[model samples]
Target: MSADIPATYTAARPAATAEVSRQAWLVWLTSERRAARLTVETYGRDLAGFLGFLTRHLGAEPTLADLARLTPADFRGWLAEAAADNLSNATRAKKLSAVKSFLRYVERDHGIAVAAIGLVATPRARKPLPRALTVIDARAIATEIGEVSDVAALQARDTALFTLLYGCGLRISEALSLDRGQAPLPGSDAPLRVMGKGGKTRIVPVLPLAREMMARWVALHWQPAGDAPLFLGARGKRLDAAIAQKSLRTFRRQNGLPEHATPHALRHSFATHLLAQGADLRAIQDLLGHASLSTTQRYTEVDTAQLMAVWRRSHPRA
Candidate 1:
């Protein structure tokens, strides 16, 4: 079993064949599938729960053959139990998805088809719309976030990071992944190349203000090297996403910014503001590096919601 799959999750031990296949499936997920560590762990726990249920339902530890013999009713019973436990629809859907993925893997890799499991329907969950900060708030965050840091370089780094996030609509992970050599400078017209989710690469234009802040931070970089991380922690290692998030949290509390004013909100603000200004939806999709235009379309919903709020306040109609 992968070390990432904790040995102590709420699970009954599977029979030998099931245990071996489960271990192999997890290895495939982490290695060949390139699934994120957290994703793997969550799926692992979901599968563990399913196995525990099977152990009780069958009156013995489940085996590969037992998984193939599972009926849709068995799956429904598990869903019913989860619903009784007060798991949200979204949580139940995710658990169901994990179970299906594992079953698919078993069929493909081990030639042990659990065709009955495929008959289960996934619970529908409403995806929450992206919450964007007002333009005034986004601009204020990019400018004032640095105040949370006393060290001049740290201040510049935080300011630069937030500026880039808003200006280029880069995810925090994508921004933190950049190297010193990829840093943009003032007057450089070349667009910044970002490696986004699923290892997809896309180039985004960097505004002059973002470039200016980045240049300032680069100037104060400690022992800078071409291959070194563009963003650094106090210990000179690559900055952790958690640390950057905490800095924003601290700044928000100090400045009374909305609780939703997060690093990601800056990215959401970028796309929403652009959409409101009549930028092409397709172009915004490319800039955001979204594989599907539907994903980028969420910004339109945010934009429409903002417009409705403005109209409601101004129309003065009873």
Candidate 2:
């Protein structure tokens, strides 16, 4: 029953040459890859942790030449240390990905190829199934979420935003990124052209109710014109994601909704509901703008689990 001891490792400081490469990679991540600030910082920490492990394992400061000489065993030792820390497989996997990304950058950009790093197997991280709202709950969020807001415009905004999310299966980022000109009109049959992840665009049909609500909100929007944001903040600027999430959190808290009731959950509900209604998995993938069909297949697991739950509740054999 003794607690696991911490690894007695210190990160080896990089030589000036290696340090220059690391800094340059970080800069490239920011400017060229357009990585988020948090991602850059997290990858920086992961790399630092790997270097720390190398310091202890190799008993010396790591140079660019040392990086080029790293073996699969060396990478495994670092992963072992992370495992010793009780980090989940997902976290370990992300750490490995960060190290691999750094090594790839070093090889490509600085001509320091660590070919042995490629021999190391990546950690298998089990992604949790997406949590979706029931059909009643999803519809309630779209129609009644506005009750939490007193201001007429805010109420209308909440209704329209949730409606669009549930109807169109958009990620919050995708929905928030919409320009005023892209807003679906009340009576139009035009499919929405959404710029999804990786700068890929997909067309999603808007629900008539969603369009009607969107048109209502647009009518009340201040300066709703060419190239302006589709959804405006209280200060007439583009609405922040945090603000939208907070609005939903407030609504859920007030309405006795489950903690899983989030804007993204509405998207999940959209997919799940469509699946229940016999929508094709590939078609759902296109609607959600998922690059992979496997990603869309997770909803099938969710649907199966729900059916099992219903069976448990209603079947006579139990």
Candidate 3:
């Protein structure tokens, strides 16, 4: 039997209308609602993709009626296609959220009601448990930094970096993005200013050891001009994220820690250890810069495990 001939598919391109798209984007930015820049950018991109899809698949610009005609089943089909193409649930949810927001914006700004767009529900994702290093393992990894004798400055930098990660629960990106000009010395009782996600900034207290390590490194390699990368690479460039991960992996393997040991694990350890020591959930939420209390509640699950272990050991009814 002869194989069936493949059908050719042709995508339609919409005529360029830069003016309309630009006006829409500008309105999104200047609107009184005060959305985050990242959110605006993300929604803009998602809406553009949907518009492109309409032109490509249906050979016409998408009218409000066109969007209104879509069923939840149709949206689910699109989401399935995205998943089949290897998109993560987080990415899919972001895109769907963007589409929903855009639909709302069109209704409010242009007086076009596309009710069907609201039917697309985002996929639910389970929040993974935070991975953390044990206190002994964290100290052990720090000790191995001293073994890198060939690069004494790097030893101090790595020690301080890891110390801040576990000590203050800083994301690796936040720690590396620090500049020398931004308050070299954090006061003994004060919190260090850290730039977090979506350009939001937060204050995190410094551990004495972390502070000492940072001060010593600064004094030895300190340049009077405060406008340089806080942590420099061997070539005097800003340290890259990959290098930080590689260093952590090497230290974990050398010190016999679990394979899951990562820079993020230090953050998890910081929260977990704090919860064990009776830190309030709300305070932990503030420290982590979580937008929702439910996000901070996950750490309590870590605390629960610890509580169960103590109960088993101390209870006489066992």
Backbone clash total for model 2 is: 1
Reference-based TM-score of each model: 0.63, 0.64, 0.58
Give the winner by lDDT: 1
**Candidate 1's error at 4, in angstroms?**
57
Looking at candidate 1, what is the lDDT of residue 59? 93
Ranking by lDDT: 1, 2, 3
Clashing pairs in 2: 11-52
TM-score of model 3 relative to the true fold?
0.58
Cα lDDT of candidate 3 equals 0.73
lDDT of 3 by residue, 196-279 (tens): 998888888777778887876676567666778888787888889899889887766676779988888888888888888899
How do these models rank on TM-score, best leading? Answer: 2, 1, 3
Candidate 1 C-alpha lDDT tens digits along 1-318: 677776633132344356566777889999999999998888888988988888888998888878888899999999999999999889999999988988888777656788887688888886899999999999999999999988999999999999999999999999999999899998789999899999889999999999999999998984447889999998989999999999999999998999999999999999999999999999999999999999999889888888898899899791
Better of 2 and 3 by TM-score: 2
**Per-residue lDDT of model 2, residues 1-318, tens digit only:** 234633321122234355566777899999999999999999998888888788788787678889988888988888988999999889999999998899888777656689888799988888988999989889999999899888999998989999999999999999999989999987789999999989999999998999999988998984537689999899988999999999999988988889999999999999999999999999999999888999999999999999999999999996
The runs of at least 3 residues in candidate 1 whose Cα sits more than 4 Å from the true structure, single-residue gaps closed, are: 1-123, 222-224
For each candidate, what is the lDDT? 0.89, 0.88, 0.73
